[model samples]
Target: MNYIALSYWHLAIASILILANGMISLWFRLGLEKTLAINVVRMLVQLSLIGFVLKFIFVQTSPLWTIALAVIMVLVAGREVAARLTTRLAGWWSYGIGTTTMFFISISTTLLAVAFVISPEPWFAPRYVLPLLGMVLGNTLSGISLGLETLITTLKRERTAIEARIALGHRRFEAIEQPVRQSLKTGMMPIINAMAASGIVSLPGMMTGQIMAGADPVEATKYQILIMFLIGGATATGTLLAVIASAFRLTDERARLRLDRLENAGSKNV
Candidate 1:
C-alpha cells in the first residue's frame, strides 16, 4: 500500500483541537495545567507507538500477540477503574471485576452472533476479536469510571442521610438503592443514546472504518449494529456491577458507613 505524508497544513489542522483543549484547560482554570501538557505528550507518543505496534502485530499475525495486546488493554483499564474508585482495595480484585465482566460480555455477544448470525472464517480471528473487544471494553471503561465517580460522590454527599437510613432499619442495598440505580443509569446512558441515535445522528466509527476500507455499506452497518447492541449489554452489566462494587468500599463489615475510607482510596496506583 502506498502511503501519503501529511503536509504542514494538514498537520496544523489536525492539531487544532489539541491546542484548543490545552488552551481552554488553562483559561478555564481546569487545574490541569500540567495534566494537559502530559496528556498531549502521552497521546502523541502513545498513538505514534501504537501505530507501529499495530503494524507489527498485524504482520506477525500471531494469536498470542493479539490475545496479549487485548489482555494488556484490559489490565490497563482495570488499573484505571481501581485508581478512580478505591485504590486500597488490593490487587487483582479490580482486575477480576473489570476484565471478567469485559470478557464475559464480549465473548458472549460474539459467540451468540457467530453461532446464530455471521459465521466468519475463524470466528476468533484476531482482527475481528480485538476490535470487537476494544469497543466493548472502551465503552465499559467509561461506564465503569462514571459509576465509580457517582458512587463516591454520592456516598460523600449523603453520608449523613445514608447513616440515618441504616439506623432506621434498612439493608445496605436498600439504603443505597436510589443512588446506586441512579449511578448505573447515568453511567449507561451515553452508550444507550449512541445506540438509539446511531444511524440518524452519526456515522459510527466502526462502520465508517469498514466502509472506508471498501466494505459494502450494508455489511458495515450489520457489524456496527451488532457491536452496538453487544456494547450496550456490556455497559449495563459492567456499570451496575462496578457501582455495586464501589458501594462495598464505602461500607464496612457491619454494613456501616466508612467515610474515612475515601481519603485512602483516591490514590492512583499507576
Candidate 2:
C-alpha cells in the first residue's frame, strides 16, 4: 500500500478526539479548557511550522543547513531541560549542564549512526542525520532534565544528612553518592520501560511510521531497534554527565552542601 497524505479536513476530523478530553475536564470542573486550548494551538502551530521548514530543507543538499538546524535544536533542548527543573543551578549553569551534555552525547551518537550505521552517500544528509539527531536529542534532554532535577531536589531535602556525611570526612562524591545513583536510575527508567514494552505492548513511532511508508516490517524493525539502542546509550551518558556536573555545582571545595547555589527556575514572578 502506498503512503496516504493527510489534508486539513482530515486533521480537523481527527481533532474531534480532543473534544472528548475537553468534555471530561468540564464534567469534573477541572478548568482545563484554557490550558488545553492553548496547548492544542501551540502544538498545531509548532508542528505546522516544522513541516514547512522540513519540506524546504529536504530539497537542499548543503550540510550547513543540517548542521545549523542541529545547533538550534540543541540550544532549544538545553533551555527546555533547564526550564523544566523545579530547582536548578543558578545562572547559566542550569542551561549549561543540560545543553552541553546533550550536545555531545546526541550529536556524537547521531554522527556515528549516520556515518557508520546508515552510511548514506553524503554522510551529513538531512534525511538521515536530522531525524537521528532529533530523536536522540529529545530523549537525552528528558534524561538530563530528570537527572538534574533529581540531584538538585535530593540535595535540598537531604541537606542535614549530606552535611553530616561531610562532617564524618566523606568527600562530596561520597556524601551524595546515593542520590547520584538514584538520579541516574530515575533518568534512565523511562527509556528502560519503553524498551521493555516496545515489541510486546507497543510499537514505537519510528517503526510504525516506516511500516506505514511501505518499508518491509523486518527492515523497519531493524531501524527501530538501532534507533532505540542509540537513544538508550545517549540518554544514559547524558544523564550521568549532567547529573555529575550539577552535583559538583551544588557542592564546594570544603565538601559543604551549597543549596544556596541553586535557584528555582521556570515561569514565575520574580
Candidate 3:
C-alpha cells in the first residue's frame, strides 16, 4: 500500500481550522467554550494515539491486541454512560443502567452485524469489530445521555402527579409510564429527525467520509442506510434499557415513588 504524507501546507491549514473552531465556539456563546476546547483537544490526542495503535495492531494482526482494544472500547463507553446518568441515579443503579443499556444494544447489534453482515474471517476482525463497536457505542452513548436527561427532567417535573398516581394504588412503573414514554419520544426525536431528513438535509458523517475516500456513491449510500437503521435500533434499545433500569431505581417496596432516595445521586457515588 502507498503511504500518503501530510505536507506542511496541509498541516498549517488544518491547524488554522482547529483554531477557528475554538474562536468560533467562543464567538457563538455556545456556553461551553472551555468544554469545547477541552473536548477538541482530547479528541485530537486520543484519535492520534488510536491511529498509530490501530496501524500497529492491524499490521501485526494480533488477536490479543484486538481483544484488549475491544475491552477498552467497552470500558470507555460504560464510563461515558455512567457519567452521563450520575446526576440522576445512585451507585449500583447508575452502573446497572449504563452497563445494561450499552451491553444489550451494542452486543446484540454487533453480534448480528458481524455474524451475518460483515462475516469477517474469524468473526472478530479488529478492523471491522472496532469500527462497528465505536459507531454503535458512540451513538448509543448519546442516546442514553439524552434519554437520561429527558426521563429525569420529566420525573422531577411530574413528581407530584406521579406520587398521587402511585398513592392511588398504581404501580411505580404504571404511574410513570406516560412520562416515560413521552420522555423517550422526546429524547429520540433527534435520531428520528435525522433519519427523516437524512438524504435531503445531510449526507451524514459516515457516508460522506466513505464517498470522500473514493467509495462509490451508491455503495456509500447503501452503507449509510444500513448504519442509520442500525443506529436507530441501538438507540431505541439503549434508551428503553436505561429508562427501565432507572425506573426500578426510583421505586421502592410496595411500588411507590421514592424521590427522597435520589437526593444523594451524584458524581461522588458514581
Candidate 4:
C-alpha cells in the first residue's frame, strides 16, 4: 500500500473543523475563538516549516545539523517549562533548572533508544534521532512544567505548614516531602493515563502513522510500546528532577522556607 498525499484542497477542506470549533466557541461566548484561530494558524505554519526543514535535514544527514536541531528543541522546551510556572525562582535559576533537567533526561533517553533499542545506521541518523528526541523532549517538557508549577504553587500555599514542620525539627526535605511527591504524581499523571488508555480508548500517533504508511500492525504496535515506555521513563526522570530542584530552591541551607526566592505569579517582571 502507498501513502496518500494530501493536497491544498484537502487541507483547506480539513480546516473547516477548526473554523467550526471557533464558531462554536464564539456562539457560546467561550472567549476562546481568538485563541483557537490563532493556535490553528500557528500550528499550520509551524508544522509546515518543520516539515520542510526536516526534509532538508534528512537529505543532508549530518550529525552536526541533527544535534543542533535537537539542542534547539530542548532549549525551546525548557523555556516553555519556565514560562508555564506561575511563580518562579529568582534570576535564571528556574529556566536553568528546567533546561538542565530536560536536556539530561531527554538526551539520555534518546541516546539509549538510538544506541541500544533502535540502533539505526550511523547511530545519530537525523530521521531516527530527531523524532525520538522530539518525542521524549516533548513529553518531558510537559511533565517537568507541571511538576515545577505544582511544587512552586504548593510551596507558596502551604508555606506556614511547611515552616511549622521545620520548626518542629523536621528536615526541610521531610517538611516538603508530601508536596514534592504530589507534584511528581501530578506531573506523571498525563503520561500514565495515556498509557492506560492507549490501545483501549484510542490509537497513539506513532502507531497510527506507521499503520497509515502500510507497516504491519504488529510491528507498529511493538514500536509504539517501546516508544511509550521510553517516554514514560523520560517523563518520570524529568519530573522528579524538576520537582526536587524547585523544592530545594524554595528553602535555605538553614532549613527555613525561602518564599522570598519566588516572584509573585502576576508580577510584571521577574
Highest lDDT scorer: 4
Local accuracy of candidate 1 as per-residue lDDT tens digits, 186-219? 8998998887788989999999878877788899
Per-model TM-score versus the true fold = 0.85, 0.93, 0.88, 0.93
Candidate 1 colliding pairs, count: 0
Q: For candidate 2, give the lDDT of residue 34.
A: 90
Among all windows of 10 consecutive residues in model 4, the one with the lowest summed lDDT is 261-270
**Which residue segments of model 4 deviate by more than 4 Å?**
24-30, 265-270
What's the lDDT for all of these models? 0.74, 0.88, 0.78, 0.89
Q: Which stretches of candidate 1 lie over 4 Å from their true place?
A: 1-9, 83-100, 106-118, 264-270
**lDDT comparing candidate 4 with the true structure:** 0.89
**Pick by TM-score: 2 or 3, better one:** 2
Error of 2 at 214 (Å): 1.0
Q: Tens digit of lDDT per residue, candidate 3, span 7-115?
A: 8688768777777767786898767778777887898789889999999888777779887887778777877776665356755666667776787788788878889
Note each model's CA RMSD in angstroms. 3.1, 2.0, 2.7, 1.8
Question: For model 3, how big is the CA root-mean-square deviation?
Answer: 2.7
